[model samples]
Target: MAFRYLVGRGKDRILVDTGNGNAEYIQAFQSILSTRDLTLSKILVTHLHPAHAGGLDPLSRVTWVSSPTIMKHGHSPRGFPNLTSIKYTSLTDGIIIQTSDGDTTLKVLHTPGHTRDSIVFRLSEEDAIITGDTLVPHDGAASVVLEDPVAYLASLRRLDALFPKLAYPGHGDVVVPATDLIKRSIEEQMQLPERIIEALCSGGGIMDARDMVRRLIADAPEEARRNFTGTVLQHLLELEKRGKVRKRSVPKRVPSAAYEERDPDRIKGPGGLTLAQVSKLVKESRAKDDKVYGLKPVEKSQEKGKDFSGAESGKSGKLERSEVVQLHPAHRELEPLVEVVWSVV
Candidate 1:
């Protein structure tokens, strides 16, 4: 989770990234709001990822503000009300916030690698920067999977020159000696494209995003693979955006489509399957209706690859990295399965 700051004066309060829509997140946010007795004046969403912007659904009464570039997506989670999007708000560098108690300005540094609208807020008074997934204090590698390496590299360099002391990120502890932290983060992120290009240039042989993720971090634990894969997709998408890679070559899935296909309602799973695909899997699992009765894979005798079932029986469904065969759900179960996937996506 990225750390969000509440910077305002007197009675007004600004809520940063609402976190997710889970019980823990909702309770925490409610507690915080109750303690401060603050009604959300402005909700600043750094980007539209679920972990950062998922909580906006509950705070529908507030004015939601986001980069003009991101505003086109409309309010997140789809059905929220009182949504107001502001664009063409030339927030290239520092932006000033006018309040009754003078000015509480924030330096809006648009760092594009993590996401197109990803920004880092710098508070001069505290000498602290709010790095939204761009720089983590520990074990925090820039989310390269779906990021633009070129823009990301530039963003890192800019951060290095701007602040030299400390950084408070979306998650984890604060980073001291900010210059060093920025340098290392940039260096590490810069290598991602090169590595991918190398693997592609070598014998990796036109691997998809998922394959590249597995190859990039072979030694990482299975539990962490999904996250690492997501980060890798961020990089790949950015590369595609830069013309360094081709989008047509990438696999067509539903989850990535929420952003890639420009359809925010759909969610893509980390397994390279789209939300629609996952829903299909779950529907075929129950084998209830005649539609689901014949939901088996097209080829049963083919030993070339594993078949995908709508659902995995027992605890195997919970396994993060497994290649075992499972059952798909019945047609009736499709909607619920999709809902579950969307809740996470």
Candidate 2:
């Protein structure tokens, strides 16, 4: 889910993020301000991501503000799935916007992690931070799609040092005692290196980064899958730098062996249909998402007539595509991803 935040002082008003481009959501935002007699004068987006700034086009007449990174790339960062068409001013770190006779202040903190343009606004009056995707709730941590894991950790550390008490994230409700979440995010990231090493110990091979990503994502959810490789790749780079793991080739994109079972029957979505069938339903449905639970792999004795999706497979199969598959609605929206965990190093 996406979110739009309304921050105002007296009659002067603004929005923190624009949610999706959903017309109803935007109308409700405007209507809320109308009943309160506040005009939507300015919009400060944490980033130019469609989910956060999609309404910038429809909600004309408002001055827009975002990070220079968004404007620098022509509002279209490379690899960003959907970019918004918006003309916006650039925001910098530690800049404060004093609202309405200077009683309440918006402290714009340029905290880039999830995206190069991500930022946070600290409402001085309530000591609440509007953290757009930078520091999302863990239970709601699907929003933590990392661009650069190194920078992400640094940003989280900076937020930790600030001693924030409350947070309003990009996709979730208020995060009380925001420092706890910040520290937890930091802890999770720091442990990623160890996790990768442990995964490596589970198997043996001179593996490329792409294959390594497949191994790491065996237990990841659909939401976590998007940012999974980028996060894993960056940490692998770190591990290599420390001599914990070494690359096999000069970073050429070569074919890798299958790391997981790919039984077609195992890959299911809405109503437990195949991915292809789910794609059709997704185009016709308005469901954002629903709870998707997975079951453990079926016993080896039950594996018959099940070729590896399109290949032949036999015993010691850790899982079937169906047993560990997570059926969710939104996976259909993404393109088929065969990402490069390493940039052809």
Candidate 3:
């Protein structure tokens, strides 16, 4: 259910991100073309996701433009049925599109992380940006489904830096003051890692991703649960990279591995917030008048220490704060916090 846009001046028309390849979408697009007196000339895909690229087959005669990264994966031929007639163009950071008369121009911005191939089209003439799922505006808030938390956050910051006057996102109504929405999205994402840490710490020191998802969005509708789970997992992976948390691989008999807080006393997170500060902020955000969601830590079982190692019986092992090494190169700039001493049973 992604939105596709038709941009044109005179007879030169460009289609942005085709919707699902349903016959209805094709008919509707044709009707729009007929009503507007604009012929389909080219397609600009934001990403290679099915809902966004599905209609490419029907419009195969036109020139297609997308991320070079996506093209390497053979999206043009395998994903679209009629690649024989389509002329594929790979775009990077600075590709520009000019109308035949040269009045309107659209610049491509490589903004990956909703997918590795996501891009945004910026129409400076209109002060608008056609953002794919890389940045979405929903209910006066920006939403994102991140494939990589670090990349996604960086992309959001990049969009904010652009200071677009308006945003025509892939889904939802056009957002005014687009930079503000991007900023809000960044703030929300920044808080997610801390929220995950707090959730893990509150749940008797460790919990699997599924358990964290359930606790975080206990009241969310069924459709939203899957997306929330993905967000939780992404944050956990990032936290693990920062050495704020560690993943304990469970035996094959278990469905998922458990994630444990590396340091319960002083949980480090993005923006230098400790666990207590993050918990307070979360509680304040959810508070109504004097009422706030109670963040009581779940009762710790006698087996809490044993569970940390993912073994039935073992003394919990500890690593000196200085000895902890970050495996992810992206987190090299992140400074490890104070000494972490894990208690043994």
lDDT leader: 3
TM-score of model 2 (CA atoms): 0.65
In candidate 3 the C-alpha lDDT for residue 268 amounts to 49
- Residue-by-residue lDDT tens digits, candidate 1, 1-345: 656677666655655566765667667766776687754445566666767766555555333342112211222321222233334133454564432344454567777766666777776666777776777765545233334556768888988888647886777777887788888877787787667655433322333443454445655655455556555555555665666654321122222222333332354545455545543443333222224233322223222221123334232222122132221211121222111211111
**Model 3: per-residue Cα lDDT over 1-345, one tens digit each:** 999887766776677887877887787767777787665555778877767877666665333332111221123222223323344777678778765557678898887667667788899788889997877775321134555778778988988888899999888888898888898888888887777677666654544554465556655654454555555656666676677876443211111122234343375444454544434443333232123334332232333334434445443332111122232222222213211211101
In model 2, state the lDDT of residue 310: 38
lDDT of 2 by residue, 1-345 (tens): 567777776776667777666878767766776687765455678877777777666665333332111221223333554454456566778877654445567887777667777788889889788888888776523335576677888989988987888998886668899998998899888878877776554333233333444456646654565455445556776777877765432111211222234433356632345443333332222111111222232222343333324344454433232122221222222222222122112
Superior candidate under lDDT, 1 versus 3:
3
Q: What's the lDDT for residue 231 in model 3?
A: 56
Q: Please provide TM-scores, in order, for all candidate models, with all chains considered together.
A: 0.54, 0.65, 0.66
Order of models, best TM-score first? 3, 2, 1
Model 2 poorest ten-residue lDDT run:
284-293
Question: How much lDDT does candidate 3 score?
Answer: 0.58
Question: Model 1 scores what on Cα lDDT?
Answer: 0.51
The worst-scoring run of ten residues by lDDT in candidate 1 lies at: 336-345
Residue 162 in model 2: shift from native, Å? 1.1
Residue pairs in clash, model 2: 266-321, 266-322
At residue 150, what lDDT does model 2 achieve? 76
